[model samples]
Target: MNLFPDAVEELRLRTREFIRTTVIPNEPAPGERLNPAVRTELRAAAKAAGVFAPHVAKEFGGQGLDIAHWSPVFQEAGYSIIGAVALNCMAPDEGNMHMLELIATPAQVERYLRPLAAGEVRSCFGMTEPHPGAGSDPDALRTTARKVAGGWMIDGEKRFISGAAGAGFCIVMARNDAEDDHLAGATMLLVDMDNPGVRIGREIHAIDRAIDGGHPHVHFEGCFVPDDAVLGKPGEGFRYAQARLAPARLTHCMRWLGLARRAHDIALDRTERRELFGSPMRELGIAQNMLAESVIDIETSDAIITKTAALLAIGERAGSSLSSVAKVHVSDAVFRVIDRSIQLCGGDGVTDRLPLAGYLNEVRPFRIYDGANETHKWAIARRASSNRRREVEQGEPYRADVDAPR
Candidate 1:
């Protein structure tokens, strides 16, 4: 596939213009969240501009762009912090929308996916739990879902759940002890936030402030739902979650890539306008080195993100592993780009005087979220070593789907 799809060029350009003209001007102040009214207003403007939900399918009242199309469009929306929110493409919701569309039954789609895609309501994915529970380790899941007369009774606690406060519902992952297959014992269930057993705790104070509702702690005590609430097949939650994570990770890269680029642009603008020692700062060799480094980081990041996006589009098994690599590389690269931009801007970068300062705060958290960079590094090394052994023993080229002999 072409690096830049010709068909989505207009939509991508439109999104960039909208973000530059509409969204950036209305960025919420540091430590301040966007009010619901303002969010509604921005969403309306985005819908009117035809850039709303550009990655969602047309059947769901979205722009119907595929993963390839989303790469460019999401990057454009990332230019402004509110750009993704205005376009209704922010995470948890965006990722949940993808999950439901792929696995939700027709009824589940009608009740959950449709409204979410249309931006009628918000949603969250309940996965990471407290220390004693599941955080990073899916096998440590303490949440249990027992089969009941009509449905399942779920009991668990989830922390750092983004958008849980005002969310209409959540896609909860829980362990099913009844299943025979160890890997298949985990299942996903749809639970309405209004359910009696569902309790939303205080919003976690995180470094980043862009996500709606912030991240909240949640408790599910005997949460009951009908059989229809099951997302796909019972005991297949882990598989489905993996499906969601691969693309979600890439989307994160795409959005952050845009933010880093924005930081670079702000830095370049500042350097060009500010003169030091009777010459433009950008013309100075020191400043030129910083600019050159940022350009390399940005280009390398784009190459990895685009290549990974292509792999995902083709349904390659290596896509998942590559996505992990992309997540690690792009997250760190983008962080450097933003950090360099901050240093280049000097005092203005640290202060909220310009967008680079805030972008720095925003991009910093990306390394930890969506599977920590260190975790990805471990996985990458483990997989590479295992794949190499298999190649040596079998005298064959390494393939993504190959599993090391037990």
Candidate 2:
């Protein structure tokens, strides 16, 4: 039997259909960016289909689906490159929206969350920065936020910020000069992108072109943001980031999982039709082995994502631990699946004749984003060691309980 409830199942099917039909048809041509007009049209179509922003609250014009219900729906929407775009579930807007809902004041929600959920504008999360700053290590954050009368002055440079180019505003992470501890001083602020002192550099061309507003560098020089723009409390940016990233990491897995599945489907279709050595490629022993490995990878990734999604839904103690594991495993597994599929498809895979080419570029960067797999692996190891030590001291059976790393 299917794991999802009937309503979730139905929503999943509808989302799949919407992606296969509406979103895929309007996807940008090879090497082309999605134009504004097409984006508007897609948003309108998704709204009409009642699938826009499925993860946001119903009061804010979204379906208000929880994390568990969102898993299948997001995967289905991920079938096409533009699927999440049509539904307005694409990040960093998706992640930003989630954060705002959890912590923003009602007025803040009205100003930012509502418009964002409605797909009226986009947003970015500013945390990553150039070398010598907070690229992988958040403690290395150099951006400073100093309190001023009636406002705050934010100063720093952020690089490789996704969705920053065209975003209306950004949830900026900066160090609070008031606090002595760098980590404790970090804060989140909502700054309008158009502020006089906020300068957005040209988009940084990246391997992945699927995300709108290509990752860009931003400079905040004496950018004055009102006191009301602080997200949550002044010193809780890292905490809030952790809350945002856990779910965001899962959603990224869900989307890439769908694309990886699609890659395999393309390869399978090619194998069935192409003749090699007087037999269909699918009949070859080597081809079968590749296909089997891909199947296994996809199945494993799906199982982990599903189980993790369920755990997250129920707020299980092991949920965060599982999410980190899922993020690392699924990201790598999906990449392998796409790679094998590309090999299986031969020339067609590397070409635009199939989706594998773009998918490779799209999935490659995932290994580095969210939290790097290396970093996650390090956290996982530490957690395991700590858990083992505690269990041994208590004379209990060996058990590991780990939470998501901040």
Candidate 3:
């Protein structure tokens, strides 16, 4: 069942208006540089319009819209590459806010979550490590937090950390050597980005052009945090990260779905007008096939995301199986749609004349981040096999036909 209320349609209309008038119009040109001050002003304006942070709860000064309701709104925001930035619901920050709200202590909330929720401060989640470390395999976390005095001493390096440059704080993941199991040994520490021991190594210029804070290489050289800096339980870092990723990836899919839609629309407009071989592009059979395939991909991606969102809203962790399906399907689907759009736009698509090229570049990483598609596939297959084995042991009919094609 969907989670959107009957009033959601009205809300969606208002959201569309806000996105069109306030967000899209304010986005920087393709070649234009990012201006933090201008972004801040746009965020303030979005906050005033009552459309900021749709995914966050009301207690955090957000609209408190649930997944179903938020899906359309976020999709609308995705139309412009900078739409989420203007609304203050962009990545790293949005996911960080959710984690802090769920696990941060009262004092920690006041110190970090409050400013973060209010968009007064920004934060990043530091988990990705350099090669031979925690990249996709989180169990390979090399960062360590050792017990020392009244708190812990954190020392390690984090690579590809988003929002670190201008972030006020970071939710740092480190291995707790005290734990017997390395997976359970992980601990999340809230560290001030400006901590003396916390060094900003280098700014990585990612393919995504609209990212507010450049992804930074972060070094934690004996960064000490008090006992209170621990988020949730001491050794629940992996669990907390898993929980955060489930919804975070879904949100990404939702936003990127919108981006794909925008590309598709742009392509359609071009196809209807541009002529090739003495006929409009839209009259070509290949053009029609591409458009048709895009529609199917986008609609299917929407359905899968909506179903997963409903499961999440009811407090059921759909886990890696469903999430993996959504991730792989959506990632591939959106990429294909964007690719087709670029093809339809011809040389203009590759050029900076429109947002298509940037959209394609930004979505390229979806298959890699959160979790690699190949990894997710293996996990999904293993789980499915185990479930089938259990069913066979219990002498239950497998009913493979129900899920398989004729």
Give the TM-scores of the predictions, in the order they appear: 0.95, 0.95, 0.94
Total colliding residue pairs, candidate 3: 0
User: In model 2, which regions exceed 4 Å deviation?
Assistant: 178-183, 397-406
Per TM-score, the best of the predicted structures is 2
Worst 10 residues of 1 by lDDT: 177-186
Candidate 2 structure quality by residue, lDDT tens digits, 22-95: 88888888777787899899899888988889999899999889887788898888888888888999989999
Per-candidate count of clashing residue pairs (backbone under 3 Å): 0, 0, 0
Candidate 2 lDDT (Cα, whole model)? Answer: 0.89
Off by over 4 Å in 3: 1-3, 31-33, 179-184, 397-406
Off by over 4 Å in 1: 178-184, 396-406
lDDT of 1: 0.88
Report the error of model 1 at residue 91, Å: 0.4
lDDT values, one for every candidate: 0.88, 0.89, 0.85
Using TM-score as the measure, what is the rank order of every candidate, best first? 2, 1, 3
